[model samples]
Target chain A: MTSDSSSTAGSPEENATSSSVSGATALQDVSEYSGADDDLQKEIQTAVENLECCQSEIESLNVKVAKEILKVKQNYNKIKKPIFDKRNEFIMKIPNFWLTSFMNHPEMSKIIDDVEKEVLQYLTKLEVEEFENINSGYRIKFYFNPNPFFKNEVLVKEFSLGASDQFVSESTQIDFRRGSKLRKRLRDYQKMISKAKKRSKKSEEALPRSFFNWFVENAEDSNDIAKYIKDDLWSSPLQYFLVSDV
Target chain B: MTSDSSSTAGSPEENATSSSVSGATALQDVSEYSGADDDLQKEIQTAVENLECCQSEIESLNVKVAKEILKVKQNYNKIKKPIFDKRNEFIMKIPNFWLTSFMNHPEMSKIIDDVEKEVLQYLTKLEVEEFENINSGYRIKFYFNPNPFFKNEVLVKEFSLGASDQFVSESTQIDFRRGSKLRKRLRDYQKMISKAKKRSKKSEEALPRSFFNWFVENAEDSNDIAKYIKDDLWSSPLQYFLVSDV
Candidate 1:
């Protein structure tokens, strides 16, 4: 995340240039300066260097701050684990619990189609596990009982902080059963897109409108859903579960 | 600030209402339940209560997390104090240091008028002191030499976190010199506004275009300038000071 220091400064040179008085103009004023002004400029340069040193020190302190904050978060996560486990156990007793919770979520509900809704009825559990570093990222797992749609009992989506600290995600490949409704629909959609592309070279292929597509999609630009699930839904699934109850 | 718990849940009833399935509809479905469904409902309620208990525990942990984070920030502040003091001492050696820094700032320069620019030329120092509690808010003080613009040695603006945790600010009253240029301009602007008001009852009185007015104005809605000064400029004034340099 560039440690807050770089984020706040935001390319100081760029900021200086974009200002009402461009840096070059200010420099021009400096170049035509009096002897007294030259002394002041030298003093200003010294002050600037000193300030930069202080900033470097603060940046180091901020790195420590980030580490300490992470420790605090990890400690709390440890304390909350057992409590969450108990909650998860109780939640599993109710039919369509995970499905209902997802259905009730504002963002989740928006992407769920009728076919996806039917498929999600088999979902028995949903779990979010943040990586040990916490900052590294998290994984979201969807557990399903014996379902006619897919062979896998569990569908997993994992997000990890890449080299540049951007969240990159990978998901478990869903093994679809022969003539599965979702599979057939996806094939038809792909065929239509390919036909459209053949007719018009400029045609852009649209991602299929289905919840399952979320797993295969590289949603680096729009990972809000993953964040919502991890930070919000994971923290208190009960609220979302009871969202259908007045 | 209502503690992270309340913010995350966000009035669950309201959320439930806005969902595709109304709570009442879900309730109606429950009402027409079979014997097994009734048993499941009872169990789900117990699960909900258990999950709520977990949420309360996590919320308490979050409160502690907030405290620890604040302590870390405060400790860094303490460590950075002397370094910042030294930087400030060096900065004072340069003429028009604060004025130049402000002029180079993208946000600060936008609000500075020509007369304000002249008054600011006399500005010798700027300091931003965050409240000890950190979250409670901070104060920004602009120190000026005995300039012809105003009588105040230091113009102070303080921000405090109100009962509801919203930032509320109060600024020092500027004592203008007799027939001061800024004072005369402001008077003329006020006269123009009153005349416009008399001509049309609906005339909106615009804030006078002068930098000194910033001291008297309540900028709660747009306190980004204050924030920039505190979080950005205060940390490293030299960057902004030398912004005019290549």
Candidate 2:
């Protein structure tokens, strides 16, 4: 993945940036280090190359995960595939890891998909309804809702291991072990961000100041004028509002 | 689902217990509360019936989950169904709820099945490798391996909504809400235990020392034995073992 020999080491992203910038009518695409001695230019070039290397690795990692998802999809039913080859075999097909993560996550309740919403409604209808408000006959209902294991911070899921039988899956053991991996990844991300900030100096410089100019310009992740400008630049921040009248 | 007018209303569990002791032997295998009416026979009978209702409900719940799994399996190619299906699919296939119960559980880890053993192995191998001292020359050597993940307690995962943009499906939102659901069930379980103890004055006579002998021998859940003994006979406290032994 390292083509550091290239003038920019030119990461997948940087190259794309370079490509966009080169499209201007009369502008000469700079050879990266604009001024100074040959030695300085080489040094700046090396730094850029290393940053590009990181970006390259990041791109490859993305590809790797993409490939993994595809593979998992292809062999989706391999182990117990035949057992669940038909519909209505299992009402809840959530994977164990995702479920564990979901149980631990805060935004879990809102993760409902179209199908789950339908299912929830079906289950809700089964709930014995009665007037919660006696005067108004405001009906209330409940269902066989699985109490989350982490009620106060922990859920109480019953494994099917039976009484007296407790067993932890390999994934669970890994769950605990994953902390260090996370910390390391965080550090990696931090480094990436730091390097990115340094690289952003030019991108920041390239950024047009006015709102109209910013909208027409290009940037990775599309950093618009609202994000880069000071608070006084615009009367309001650019953002999407849910359930908004405007 | 309950229709018998003579039944009590403590909880679904209470009904199951009563139904069991009240000539439930006709189904023989239907009720776990069967033959618990030597003393306070009426109350015990009522309680057993409630328990039967819960057990049946749970069984029905399992059936529903199974059917869902089947759907997910059929729609394995659907964005999130396969992932959810795999995790849930394994759970309902298990024998009892004790294994499923996560909160305030005793040492349910002692039981092992081949598949679970594999899962344990899969989870443990990562830890084992981490703890294992690898001599540079012997990369292939397999020896006394440590339980993995024990050394790590913090794990962080990254989410890129961008990835979902390119893929066929995005991951479902985490299921933190279910944590409360799980806790509620546990609390309910504790309540049942409390009520069962309140009726001990009558229940104790029914469950004589002889009956306890049989119960202690046959019962698996610590809570089950605790009820019969009217003491904390089976609470296996969680012992934090060193990572070396884990």
Candidate 3:
């Protein structure tokens, strides 16, 4: 790193004065040595260059250290990725995982009426395609085994409940036969909400007591409703729902 | 860094068994999948290879991280070297730095007689060429201005005191006038030790009283004496004897 031909050599005269300034910045002020001879000036310049070289080398080393730290972190993540993937594989094997969990929740159970509960027994599969509290809202997909009342087995529905401040939206194509188990459950949910509202002294007093009431009322904002969707406690509750038939 | 042609690809069937195990050692037991078809066996082999590649890459990154840490330390030392050298330059300019410090020490003041004190006042220069308590003995050097009695202006001494269990060695060519101040001081120091030994019931009672006595006696073992020798507090004390006349 030393570029100067005449580097500062320790001698009695050199030890007496400016040679004492060792800080890199102080060393860089080589022009301050106005009285020194040409040889001494060259020596001061050399010292300055040496200090600069040391500073740059230190900077480069710092960058190298940071880069190595990042590489190590990335490799560690790669090693852990497969372990996480393996866990997910095992989780996906159990049927009706999400459906049974929703049915068993105390808050969810309270909101679902007995008629809707009986129909949900025929729920061969329940999947939450999207359940985040983010702007897009929740999309739920339900699958059923061949039943006497419904022609199509899979039913998909989207709701904006409890995710945003806007009114809730339903995107399900409900074309079941009139008076079928699915239609009866759906009509009763609307009647319960309207009847409760008319009977209560205040609109606020019309609170949900069944799963259908919760699904409709909770869609107004994602805060409290979205939190329970991500919990791991409901992981294995739906194992029986995949095989049960109403 | 991956040279593997067949990397682990997650497929539905592959995810069905323990083929998801990503550790290199566990993946090596691919033969256990003998019941599976040829295609499945190939897929397992690929997964094992991918895991081994990941493990090796992580190992290489670890080595890189260690090397970078060492480089940073080496560069840091480079920056400190010049600062230390500059400090030494300033320290060297003080003429009687070490000597005056030694004369002022409370332990050193009591041992030197009046005549020796007067002679030490003439001290002009003092330097410690080497003072490490390593395998080799400690080496000390002193310089003085022209005086009324001494021919030589420089003196050199070596001591193992406070460093090892051995004798102190004075290598200086001390050809002073027979009764000169330097000779008197030396003689009195030996006399003091012997006199103290004779008068005291125990030899321990004649322990070092002055810095010189301490230096001479402490040389017997490095313990505490060797410690202060390296301290900047005891600068140069023997500088005066180099020029004093008795």
Which pairs clash in the backbone of model 1?
A: none
TM-score of chain A of each: 0.76, 0.23, 0.44
Q: State every prediction's TM-score relative to the real structure.
A: 0.72, 0.18, 0.28
lDDT of 3 by residue, A1-246 (tens): 111122222212111122222345444444445577778666656644443344344344445544543344345445544543443343334333344555546445445566665655556554444333222345555666566445667765454433223334454454576568756665666787578878985756744455443343333432234334322212222222222221
Model 2: which docking level applies? incorrect
Off by over 4 Å in 1: A1-45, A163-165, A183-214, A244-246, B1-38, B163-165, B178-221, B244-246
lDDT of 2 at A21: 12
TM-score, structure 2 vs. true = 0.18
Task: Give residue B242's lDDT in candidate 2 (0 to 100).
Answer: 7
Find the candidate with the highest TM-score and give its number: 1
Native interface contacts kept by each candidate, as a fraction: 0.47, 0.00, 0.02
Q: What is the TM-score of chain B alone in each candidate?
A: 0.76, 0.20, 0.44
DockQ of each: 0.28, 0.01, 0.02
Q: Given the true complex, what DockQ would model 1 score?
A: 0.28
- Candidate 3: regions farther than 4 A off: A1-246, B1-99, B104-106, B110-113, B131-135, B160-173, B201-203, B207-226, B234-246
Query: Can you tell me the CAPRI class of model 1?
Result: acceptable
C-alpha lDDT of residue B6 in model 2:
18
As for candidate 1, its interface RMSD to one decimal place is 8.0
